[model samples]
Target: MNEKNFEYLRDQVKYTGFGEGLESELKEKMQQQEPSFSLSHNAHYGTDTATVTLNFKKSDQSDMYFFNSYKVDLQKDNSKESLEQTFYINKGSNITMKEAYNLMEGRAVNKDLTSKEGQVYNSWVQMDFKEADSNGNFKLNQYHQNYGYDLEAALSKHPIKELDTAKFKDDLMDSLKKGNVQSVTFMKDGQEVKHYIEANPQFKTIKAYDGNLKRIDNRQTKDEKQSEGQNTSMKQENKRQNQSAEEDGPAAPQEAKKRKKKQFNSM
Candidate 1:
C-alpha cells in the first residue's frame, strides 16, 4: 500500500468537509487499487438533508489516485423535488459540503478563487438555476471584487444589533458569507426586533425577513426615499431646462435666468 497516497487522500477528504470518519474506508478502497471508486456520505443541516458522493479516479500510467469531484443530492424541506449539483475539486480551493447545500438553496457564497493565470481573487458565487450547462449542472454566477458589492457596508445599512460588537459582527459576517440566513436583532422603534437576514450580493444589499420567515421590504430608509425623490425631481427640472434651451436657442439663457430667479423667490 502507498502510505503517502492514503495520507493525501485522507487529508483531502477531511478538508473537503466530509469529516475524518471516512478515512478508514478511503484507505481500504485505495488499497484495492481499483481504477475508479466512490464513497457516500450523509449530512443533515436543519430540516434539509444531503447525500454526497465523492468520486475517485486512478491514474493509468501511475499508482496514484485523485479525489476529483463530488455530487450533492440535496433534499430540502420546503420543496418536493430534490436538487442535485456536482462540484469539481482543484488544488487551490474547493467548496465544502455545507457550502454546497447553501448554494443549492439559492444563496451566494464568498470564496477566494484562483484564476487560470494563477492569480488569487475574491468573489461571491451563486448558482444560476435558470441556466444549465451541457452536463445538466446549474451555471455559476461570480461577482468579483471589482463588481463593487461590499458585504459589510450593506449590513451596516440595517439596524442590526450584531454589528454593535466586534466579535458578534465577525461571527455574523462569517455566517452570511457561508450563505447562512442568520438571525439578528434589529433596533426598530427603540426596541429589539428579531429578524433574519441573508447576504444578497447580486443586488448589493442584505435581504430581511420577519420572525415568521416572510421576506420584508426593508431595503431603503425614509431618508433615502426622500433623497431619491428629490433627485428625481431635480433630474426632471434639468431635462425641462435642456428642452427649453434646445427650442429657444439664443434666448434660452434669458428664459433660464428668469425661471431660476422666480424659483429662488418662491423658495
Candidate 2:
C-alpha cells in the first residue's frame, strides 16, 4: 500500500507495532473453521488515519500457535490510495524494526531466549545491542528486547519436527559441554524468539547446530552446483590448453621469437 501525507503512525505500526494484519485477517477468515483465531484491528488518527491489525491462531495439531500483526494507511482522504506495512508475531513476541530488516537481509538468529524450566527469567534488553543504517527514514536498533521463552529447552520439550529433535539434542549437549552458546532461538505460543547461549566460546551456525551440514538453498542450490561443475571443467580445459602448448615443444617458442625479431627488424 501507498500513502500521501502521513508517515509517523505508519512507522510506529510497521517498524514497531507488529507484522502485517490485512493478509492475516484473510488467512484467519479462510481458516476459521479449521481453528478459531482472532484478528483485532485498531485505527489511530493523529493528523492522519493509521489502521493497525493483529491476528492470533492456535494449532494443537502441531503443538503450536501463530500470531501476526500489521498496519495500513489511506491518507489525504483518498481512500483508493492505501499504504500498508506488515509484520509477523509469534505468540505475543514481536520483531523490532531492526530485527525485521535484519531478517530480511538474511541474518541468522544468534541469541537464545529460553531458561531452564522453573528457572528465574532474565530480561532480553540486558544484552549487547546494535542498530541498522537508516534508508533516511528511521533509525532502527539492530536488536530488540527479547519477548519469548527459552528456545533450546522449549524445543527439547516440544520438538517442531522429527529432524529438529536430533538437532535440539545436539544443541543442548553442546551447551552443556562447551558451556556457552552466543545465541539460540525458539518459538513460544506462535512467535519466534531468540536466546543467548551462555556457554559461547565459538559461534555455531544454524546449519552446524542442525548437524554441521551444508544448508541448501532450494531455489539456487542446483544452479550453484552446476556453476561449480562448469568452473571445474573450465579449469581442466585451461590446463589441457597449457599442456598442449608445452607439448608443442621449443620449436614454437623459437619460431615466435624469430617472428618477433623479423617484425622489429622491419620496424
Candidate 3:
C-alpha cells in the first residue's frame, strides 16, 4: 500500500527493527521462492491477528496507495485465525511481484473461473499468502509482506490465455513467444498454473480454447473470414480490369489515329 501514507502504520505496527542486512536476507529468501512460491508475513497483536484487505488494481495505475485496501495479520500463532489466509512458506523461498501477477493473469492456470455468487466480472480476488514457524504452524514472516499486484497493469503487460492445444492457434502462440521471454507462474501450495497466449489470425480465426483440439466455432470467426474473402475477390477483379485496359491500349489509339487521318484526307 501507500508507503508514505498512514498504511505504513495502519495496524499501528511499526516496522519492527529487523537486523541490518534484513532486506538482503529477505531478497535472498525471495529468490528461493523464485521459479514458483510465495512467503507471507503478518502483523501480530497480543492474542489477536491483525487484518488487511488488498484490492486489485481497479484502474490502470498503482492503487496500493488508497484504492487497494489490505490488512496485515499480526497473530503470533501461525496457526491462529487472523488476517488473510495464513500458511508458512518454506525458508529460502519467496515470490516476485511479476510472477505473482502472472498467476492471476492466467499465466499458469487455464481452468475457467466459475462466477461465484455476488462476484461480478471485475470483482476483487481474495488472494492468500503464508509463512511458517518451526512448529509447522503458519506464521507471518518477520517483516510482513505479500505479493500484491495491480491486476490491470499485470494484464496489460502480460496477458495470458488458455489457448486451444490445436494447431490453428499457432500464430498467436508465435506472437507470445516472440519476445523469447520465459515466464513461469506457480501457486502458493505448489500447484501449477498453465495458460496460453493469443494472436488473432485473419483468413481463419480461432473461436475458443476450452475443449481438446480447441472446439471450432463458426460464429465470430466467420466475420474475419468473410472480410478476407471479400478483399481477395476485390483484388482479383481489379487485376482483371487493369489487364483488359492494357491489352486494348495500343489498338484503341491506332484506331483513333486512322479515323482522324481519313477525315483530313476527305476534307
Top-TM-score structure, candidate number: 1
* Displacement of the residue 176 alpha carbon in candidate 3, Å: 3.8
Give a tens-digit lDDT track for model 1, residues 15-35: 889999999899899899999
The TM-score of predicted model 2 comes to 0.23
**Looking at model 1, which ten-residue stretch has the lowest summed lDDT?**
220-229
Model 2 residue runs over 4 Å out of place are 1-33, 36-40, 60-65, 74-80, 91-267
Question: Which of the two candidates, 1 or 2, achieves a greater lDDT against the reference?
Answer: 1
CA-lDDT, candidates in order: 0.88, 0.39, 0.32
Q: By lDDT, who's the top model here?
A: 1
List TM-scores for all candidates, in order. Answer: 0.81, 0.23, 0.25
Q: 132 in model 2: Cα distance from truth in Å? A: 14
Mind giving the per-residue lDDT tens digits that candidate 3 earns over 55-87? 222223532222222223333454644333322
Put down candidate 2 lDDT per residue, 63-148, tens digits, no spaces.
23344444333243435564444554432234554333333233333333333463333232212224323321122222223443
Error of 1 at 91 (Å): 1.6
Runs in model 1 with CA error above 4 Å?
Answer: 220-267
